[model samples]
Target: MKPFDYLSPGDPAEAVRSVARNPAAVFLGGGTNLVDHLKLGIVAPDLVVHVADLLPATVEDLDGGGLRIGAGVSNSALAADPRVRERFPVLSQALLSGASGQLRNMATTGGNPLQRTRCAYFQDVTTPCNKREPGSGCSALGGWTRHHAILGASEHCVAVHPSDLAVALAALDARVRVLGPDGERTVPFTDLHRLPADTPERDTVLEHGDLVTAIDLPALPPARRSAYRKVRDRASYAFALVSVAAAVEVRGGVITDARVAFGGAAHVPWRARRAERVLRGAPATEESYRAAADAELADARPLEGLDGGNAFKIPLLRRTLAATLRELVGEDAR
Candidate 1:
């Protein structure tokens, strides 16, 4: 690992100011993914700014029944919070479906959204990785890419975002509060991440010195009866090969409302707007669910060449999404 200065700032503003002063400076929350990349020489920041003391560590309720999750809140704490468990079970389920208990204990809400992909080439410094080293070329384009992206991938990069929490947040229409050099701003959770486009090096839409302060989850009526489903290579301690976070409101044997997001299927937590369009006002049936899922995945461009093996993920994702929707109306007293 490279030598770097560690800054222990007690104020969030001061922490972001330090990042603004040094472009190579990065915030340290749980030291989960960032520390690993430092050891692997994948990232070489000149300074590490510890922001644990700068952010609140509790989950507070908003005036209108929404939830404001502190950026410093641990994944385990967020999942176990009674309010979260009762109101947004999908978020709790998504957190628990992720890495082991130990990692979740250390991972923080802010840090979870900043996780890098687990692509093999990106981890190895010897190989060419557009995300790790832009303009060097993308090794995954013609390499082992069973877990790569099928949506929003460009010629420069085919990597996927690996965060279960993000998928749930996307479905809930959460907003991320950020503190930067210019001051404070809020961005929609779905817009936090950017497409691979030409700048594959940049993972998120956040600019220099931006620090996530909290995540504001808006009041979602359908979220009360939502669910999260993950399919992976192993039973546990593995990333999702295909995952769905779904919220459905069925009334009079019709889907009155629906919100869905998919992980391990795109460069970001892909909000299924196309599917939601098809689901709203449609009959809550297996046929309706199938059509909705298909509409969303219609634009999926599976990679060609050696990495084309991930094409199967398209069908797998479709099935996973349909099955999750089925659980929503499976027990209706029709």
Candidate 2:
């Protein structure tokens, strides 16, 4: 790995100030993903600002029925929290479905949302990638792109955002609490990530000296069943090929409300707004589920016959959403 200066700030303000002083500095949490990229020569930050001391290690419930998950809270801790498991099962499931037990134990909530893509071309410095190096062109565009994006992709880049927890957060309408040089601010989780329109190099909307301090999950109503389902090449330790995080409320045999977000199929955690619109006030039937799924994938543009692998994501995604909806509704009825 390249040589880099290291600093462990005493607090969030110090950390942000340190990062601001050094423009080429990156915050280090678990170092699971960032360290790997540094060794791969994909990222060459001159300094490493450690934030382990700047944040708390556990989450606390606020008085107003919201959760204040510390930035340094580990995935295992967050998933094992009784309040989270009961109130936000989708978030817990999404966290557990990602990485492995060891990695999860080491991974933190703040870092999990900022985890970079696993695109082969982006990791290999030998290959040209717009995300790794802007204006250099993307090798994955014509290379092994079976695992690339199907939506919100630009000609400059087609890499997918690789975060299962972020997808669930997006669906839950969670808010990201950040501390920067200016002070504190809360950004919606959906707005945290950006699509690869013209600048694929920027992964998030975070400013140069911003630090994620905590994540606030608002309380969801009772009788609303939620779950996360991921399809991958293996049962575990593999990234998703197609994943869906959904929550639906069924009353009087009709859909009262629904929130859905998709991963592994787009440049960002894709909110199924179109599907949600179609399902609201509609009957909770197989036909309605299929129609809602179809509406979501209608504009998906999948890459075909890349690396001798046919892209069947459009239909597969539709089916996955349908199955998840059915499973959630069925479980709620019991």
Candidate 3:
């Protein structure tokens, strides 16, 4: 690891100013992902601005409804919070379904969503990875892409994001609050993560010097009836081969509203807008679910051949989406 200076800012403004002044500085929230990146030589910074004291650790209730989760809040705390568990069960379920108990206690809400890809090529500094070093070219495309992207991926990169929380948050219509030297601004959770266009090196749309402050979730009634499902190589401590986060509102056996997002499928949390369009006003049945899943996946651009693993994703996505909707509707029926 490279030697670096550390600064523990007492406030968000100070932290932002410090990072803005030093372009090589990055905010140290939980140091979960940042630390790993540092060790892997993926990132080397001149200074680390610790922001634990600058942010709130508790979940605050939004006056109109919903919840304002502090960026500094631990994953375990967010998952176990009464408001998150009751109002947004999908978020809670997604958190619990990731990593392990120990790691959850250390991962922060902000860092959780901004996790780097687990693509072996990206981590192996000796290998060529667009995300790690732009213009080097992506090795995962022809090497091992079993867990690569199937949607919103460019020819430059096919690495999938590894965040269960982000998929649920996107489905729940959450917004990210960020603080920077310029001031504070709000960005939708979906907009925070970007598709790997030609510039595959930029993982997020966040400009340099921007620091995540908190995450705000709007009050949505259907979120109370939501759930998350993940299919992985192993039951524990494994990244999802495919995952689904879904919420459905059914009235008189007919779907009134629906939200769906998929993880381990794209560069960003893959929002199934096409599926939601097909689901609304449709009957809460297997046929309807199948149609919606297919409608959304029609745009899927899966890679081919032995290492691609994209072919398997097609069937897995359908099954996961279908099963998730079925489970949500079944619960509503009872």
| lDDT per residue as tens, model 2, 12-67 | 89989999888789999988899899889988899899997678787888765678
Give the C-alpha miss distance for residue 249 in model 3, angstroms.
0.4
For model 2, the superposed segments whose C-alpha errors exceed 4 Å read: 222-224, 331-334
C-alpha TM-scores of all predictions: 0.98, 0.97, 0.97
CA RMSD of all predictions = 1.1, 1.5, 1.2
lDDT of 1: 0.91
Model 3 lowest lDDT segment of ten: 302-311
Q: Residues 179-273, candidate 3, lDDT per residue (tens digit)?
A: 87789999999899889899988989898889898999999999999999999998899999999999989998999999999999999998899
* Residue lDDT tens for model 1, 1-334: 8999999986999999999999799989998999999999998999999997678899999877789999999999999999999889999999999998999999999989889988888899999988888789999877888898888899999888899999999999999999989989999998899989988889899998999999999888899889999999999999988899999888888889999999998889899999999999999887888899889989898876574568888889889988898887776616
Residue 238, model 2: Cα distance from true site in angstroms: 0.5
TM-score of 3: 0.97
Q: Give each model's whole-structure lDDT.
A: 0.91, 0.88, 0.90
